[model samples]
Target: MKFVNSLLGLSLLLAASSQAHALSRNAGQTNQSAQQESPDSPRPILLNYTLLKTIDLATLSQNLASFGIKARNGVSIYKVSYATESLDDTSLNASGIIIIPDTKAAVFPWVSIQHGTIIAKAEAPSVAPFEGLAEASQGFVAVAADYIGYGDSAALPHPYIIAKGYQKPLVDLLRAARELANQKDFDLGPLFLKGYSEGGYATLALQKALETDYSTEFSIVASAPSAGPYNVELTGVLNVEKPVVNPVNLPFVVLAYNYWLADGQLALNDIFLPAVATVEDALSGAYNSDQVFAILPSTASGLFQSAFVADFTSDQPTLPTSRDLRALLRTQTLLDGWIPKAPTRFYHCIDDNEIPVAVTEQAVATFKAAGAPSISSVLIPSPTTGQPYLHGNCPAIFSPLQWFGEILSGKAAQ
Candidate 1:
């Protein structure tokens, strides 16, 4: 198979938006029927893998304290390109990063990582991977998808919260990464999943997609999705409209989603005010997530129309426009609790201001209600003050290492 030579775009390092301070970080479908893939769906095929960088053991150990990632020896990082169909079935190339521990182990335990929300194409795994890259140091083959709009496919519109956002590229990347690992003479063993924020939501989506649609093809030994807005309809869309949400998510989700899925079907005015509607196109990738906040109003009241904002604050959404948003939210919620074949744990910080911890709690409760005893949760307290950890700080705190290390350690032993 042919491949792109320069993997993970070395230039992506400078444009990596995930570096805007640590701490960070989708829902769609009925949680089951939504995963049924057409037998003729685009099968993921590995096109190529390009060597990016080598993380030596000493370098890994030196950075261990700052990032909490510990490495035994050196590791090889590769930029990968694979064939995947777009939302409408147009063939497209997706990019991701794959890291292999430079060890002599006969079999490699693998983990697939999903990145949190990023607006710039440079913010992807090949270029940025941000926290997802941390897992690479932990003596495993760590993989992450750039999704559709980043990396090689940067020109494409980022689908944001859509189901296929994670389902398609993530699975395809996992399969392609496995193929590359095999070709390179690495044995594959246990597979696990971990992600936070947008990555967290996508993590759940990927887990369910694999379990429900590709059960015969793959299995996750365990999964941990932290601080994702699982209840999208209520906690995300509905909650963000309350006028206090960080403000950027409203325009980011509302505009990008309609652009990718309902661009022609819904008018800009249908979703935002005339001011916002006129500039909705800018929300696409023309601006990075941070840029979106700068260009758009910083407060929900300033960003949305008065009527729509009023409706969101009311007892129940009554306006046709308000109802339309709710419908969209229902299409993406993850709180339905699809049972996982393996042990799954949800994580969140109680002090999180971005995504309420209640959403994770709700997901755990739903799983328990469905008799999924293997499903549980862990609340990571603010390590410093022992108080609540807000959004941005959590990513730095979680640091992508040891977050899953202890739990996965136990599972690996069993």
Candidate 2:
């Protein structure tokens, strides 16, 4: 925890001298690609930026040493506000952290990391530094989007598992990063996407949109979307049928859908029991996940109305409200529609309880059935427990950063 604090503390130092030295506009040589910007394709994505802090090589290496990672270069952390859109296509300002590696390499690859479930707005990447710092030190220009419900859009409710909701902000952020690179006179190399849990779902959403809608504008080198509930219709909603380890997840999703999908007209009384229907107050970006968890019930039946639970769990749900909820869940599915063109790897712990390993297996099987080329899955066991790697253990045990190292080193094919 001290190391994490050291990272946050280092990010708060706002020395102007270090800031100037870190991103000296005239320091590095410009790339030919930077000079050949398309005339009509202006850099209008970036709205504004702030130099949060710069981490020196020694300090960066010390901070990452505990994770068995050695820093190769220093990095400049910037909190960037960019032009993006909400789920309804309304133009808005979204924010994210861009960690630029302080290397003389003229060009750097873009690695966008979508973070896992963070209930509080303060935990957003621009607020608290995480993997982006380590990724920057490893020579990648890492980007972490704060997403809609956090950062600049903190006033809005987070659109939890909605695919299009995650897609828009991330795509715009990448475009904004490109604009930043062009302005900084540096060239961006291949784009790599990685994320875990909710971020994993967001990564897949971004990848699908890039491949399906924006292929001509952006090309992905590879993507690792690990431990996500890709088939949300089945894997996500079925949490009600099982004893949940994480209680806040279901309520959060319900409230998100009510606000985004049903336009907040689904009526809380129709979804949750009277005792838990006021859950929106706890999930309003005010409490952390643990605090929210303590306030909610451990089982879906305990939280949701018994009749609503029965309708949801039934094979042929009769109620119109139940059917409407099912339709919304179906729309959130990332599994069936299209096959991925990039080298995609699905990583998960074999013993994960929060999100079952079967989610990945189901997705892989569906993709294989659809003739998805260059798709694979890796299920790992816990080094410490040796069994039940669990959802929290998956990221540490089968890390995407280590996987990216292999892909970059050519040890793992991309």
Candidate 3:
């Protein structure tokens, strides 16, 4: 069987936009705490922000024109560093990018974009131009987070697919964005969330966190979680066991879980074949996805030990490592509780090779069964190929930003 390189052209396929309005640097505008604070209360999440750079209208337009996107407004990109708790309640400084429109407004709607799986640190929003640029140019205060493994937290292993762990950076980034807006005198209107691939999972996770814990502090207008593995216990864990296109992700997730959840108890030799077990060099921020892909087996399961494979495939795993993995994957599953209250849409290509469409279909069914208020799924087919839309190719065809724009303009059902 031939292995498909599903990670091809990912950087170009996932290109994004961002920027904020130019306001006077007022002394009072800096981040500050309330007059009175409970002794036990934590400090503010938004520590401080630095204006990284600004892109004028012409520059933004010229850059976007290559992708057939128009830039209506210039953008200012700011690198936001904030404090957030890690998996073990350790205080960590994480970073992300916030792109605000150049034009002044009393208020702007916030669109937080959770990026998909990124290998290199350079792919992080703070370092490179990815998805939120077009959004900022469209007049939305766009933000994208550099997950724990990237940006300020680059030294640490990313908590890949860990629902609770990944949501912190995203949640804190939104808090930072809101605080930044507040300091500028203007305010943010409705809140919107959008993400694809791993981001799609993060989107649902973030939404669940906000609706469950931060309801008073924030309200979601809508969410578009595209091509995410919400059913981690069933679909997510099983997908990698097969002949997957992007095999490198298997090690990525395993290494992350080992560090964050398993206390690094699972050794490289136990999880992977000796030939490919040494992945630290490739997974480090220095190497790109293509480089990582080159080192791993074409199929994820090919990298695993036969004993591990047998245990994973069995109905009841005898191996302690396999059992530990199942337990960890179960914790990340999102199909069970907390039906989304706000309008929600799950997008996917019916024939996605990386993350199967069944993942989204099953999630929608579960949400409906749980009496979700507003839930729908958009299954898009490849316009060019007329066949399967590989995971890397789906974003270019379906438009989350356009769907979000429709909702903001009151042109789409909310």
| Tens-digit lDDT track of model 2 for 1-414 | 343345445544433443454356336631112233366975456777776667889988986776567999999877788878899999888898888999967899779898888887766777766647778888999999999989898988999988988898999999888888878889999789988889889999999999999999999988888888898878655676775536667678878998898877665677776454358777888877767777877776677777877888789878877778877888899986789989898888877777788888998898888988889888777666444456764544226677677777789753
Candidate 1 per-residue lDDT, tens place, 1-414, comes to 001112123235412432321122102221111122357974537776666566578865664544444667777666788888788878888888888888867887788887777766655677664444456666668888888888889887777777777687788888887788777777778787888788888888988899889999997777878788777766755455555656555556676567665665544464465376445654655566556666666566666677777775566788877766767877887756477667787878877877878888888888778887478777767766543467665642243345456655673321
If scored against the real structure, what TM-score would every candidate get?
Answer: 0.83, 0.87, 0.87
State in Å the error of residue 130, model 3.
2.1
Q: Give the 10-residue window scoring lowest on summed lDDT in candidate 2.
A: 29-38
Better of 1 and 3 by lDDT: 3
lDDT of 2: 0.78
* Candidate 2 wrong stretches, greater than 4 Å: 1-43, 274-277, 384-388, 396-398
Q: Give the TM-score of candidate 3.
A: 0.87
Off by over 4 Å in 1: 1-44, 129-131, 270-274, 277-282, 313-315, 383-388, 395-404, 407-414
Worst 10 residues of 3 by lDDT: 1-10
Q: What's the CA error at residue 57 for candidate 2, in Å? A: 2.4
Among these predictions, the greatest lDDT belongs to 2
lDDT of each: 0.68, 0.78, 0.77
Each model's backbone clash number: 7, 0, 15
Tens-digit lDDT string for candidate 3 (1-414): 111232323233333332222133333363244223368876777777766557889887876665567999998778788889787878898988888998898899889888888888877877665558878888999988998878888888788888878776778888888888887767899889988889899999999999888889889999999998887767645575676547656677778888888887875676687453357677776777778778767765567777887787688887988878878888888887788998999999876877888889999999999999999989887666454467876753237778788987889974
The ten-residue window of minimal lDDT in model 1 covers: 25-34
